[model samples]
Target: MELSNLTGFLVHRTDVKMTNFFTKILKQYEVTPEQWGILLVLDTERATSQKELAEAIDRDQTTVVRMIYSLEKKEIVRRIQNEADKRSHNLFLSDKGMSLKTKLMPIVKAAHDHVTKYLSDDEIQQLHEILSKLYATVKDE
Candidate 1:
């Protein structure tokens, strides 16, 4: 059987393509897709726990932790002790992170808009719903 005939192969290829596109867009910002994802989420929330960050980005805890650490070293994100749970740390965007997010948001939106430019609003919604369903199917297993 041809590898290209497999749905998983197509999905993976598309994922790689999108990631590469975003990598180029984010190159100067020095943030990867994962880092940007977490930064975006942190920007929305006043403070979020590491576990929450992992869940929000649909990533494993270890991966999220490592990315957060990198962001921390760069002074983009900092972990403050959770007041309620001293053992846990809540994530927050530093002034630097917020500033970067502001700059990155427009470029990110433009890049995404460019990718979906040919799709109608309805088509975009339908595609998103279909992808979410596919993700749930495998993720729930």
Candidate 2:
């Protein structure tokens, strides 16, 4: 088989293309893809701890801390002392972050829709399920 026809290579190419597309879009907001992932998780799960955010986003603790610091500096997120654990801090979206989410949600949804436009509803569901299973298997390994 030709190297160019390998499924893994093709998938990686597609991944890079998609990443570039999203990165371009996110650049307008001055955020990176990883930061966007963190914001998305935080939006969905409010008042999450740094450790929890790291796990939720499948990122290392140090990386999450750095992103959190950047977001804090931007005034988009705040780190409040965790009452239950004085050593830990809970993450919260600042008013600025909430406003950014509100402004960017439609753009995010549009990008999602555009990417999945070729798939039927059933196909989309199946794709999500299959990807979820694949993730679970890899995570368990």
Candidate 3:
């Protein structure tokens, strides 16, 4: 079969394209997609443990740690020792991060809107379901 006809190739290309789009959108703010994810998840979850942030962002702990370090350097996130578990830290958006998040969120929304604007609501829903099922099928391994 032609490479273009392969499911993996198509999915990979789509992911790359989306990543590139977001990279361009976020370049001025100096945030990677993974970092943006950490910020968003922390803000949404509110004072989340690193483990929780890792899972919510679909990233492994090691990668999350690295991303968190970058975020910490930028003063985008702060890590606090979990009161109950002194070993693990809870992550929160720093004041600078919150200000940046406030500014970046609408741009993020607009970027996503541009991505799905061509699809009908039903199509978009179907796409989400299909992607979720695909991830669920392979995520464990």
Candidate 4:
């Protein structure tokens, strides 16, 4: 069987292409896909510890810490000393980050639409379900 026919290869190839696509779009906004993931999490979850943010984004704590530092440097994210845990901090998007998110929501939606233009609603739903199932099956291992 050809390498392209392998499930792993196809998934990875698609991921790389999608990341590249997003990278180009996000570059103008001064955000990387990884940082964008953190922003989205903080936006929805509100104040959360770095550990929680890492878990929510399926990334390691150290990596999340580094990302948070970068976002902080960009003035897009702020770390407040956690009242309950002085050693840790809760993450929040700054005013600038909120404005950026507001601007990005539409473009991100358009990007999603562009990528899935060829897929029907039902196909898209099925794809989501399949990917979620696969992710769940392997995520704990």
> Tens digits of per-residue lDDT for model 1 on 14-115?
899999999989988899988899888996358898898889999999898889899999999989998888989988999999999999999999999999
Badly placed stretches (over 4 Å) of model 3 are: none
- What are the models' TM-scores? 0.94, 0.88, 0.94, 0.94
Q: How would the candidate models be sorted by lDDT, starting from the highest?
A: 1, 3, 4, 2
Candidate 4 clash figure, as a count: 0
What range of 10 consecutive residues in model 3 has the weakest lDDT sum? 38-47
Query: What stretches of model 1 exceed 4 Å from their correct place?
Result: none
Q: Candidate 1 vs candidate 2: which has greater TM-score?
A: 1
Give the Å shift of residue 1 in candidate 1. Answer: 5.6
All candidates: CA RMSD (Å): 1.4, 2.0, 1.5, 1.5
For model 1, what is the error of residue 15's alpha carbon versus the real structure, in angstroms, after optimal superposition? 0.5
Q: How does residue 117 of candidate 4 score in lDDT?
A: 99
lDDT tens digits by residue: candidate 3, 1-141:
899999778999999999999999999899988788877877624788888988898888998998999899999899989889999998999989988888999999999999999999999999999999998898998
lDDT of 1 at 40: 89
Per-residue alpha-carbon lDDT of model 2 for 1-141, expressed as tens digits? 997998558757978989998898889898888888877877534689999999988988998999999999999888999999999999988888888888888998899899889999999999889767767777856
Error of 1 at 54 (Å): 0.4
Check candidate 4 and list the clashing pairs.
none
lDDT of 4 by residue, 1-141 (tens): 999789778888999999999999999999998888887888634788898898989999999999999999999998999898899898999989888888888888899999999999999999999889989888989
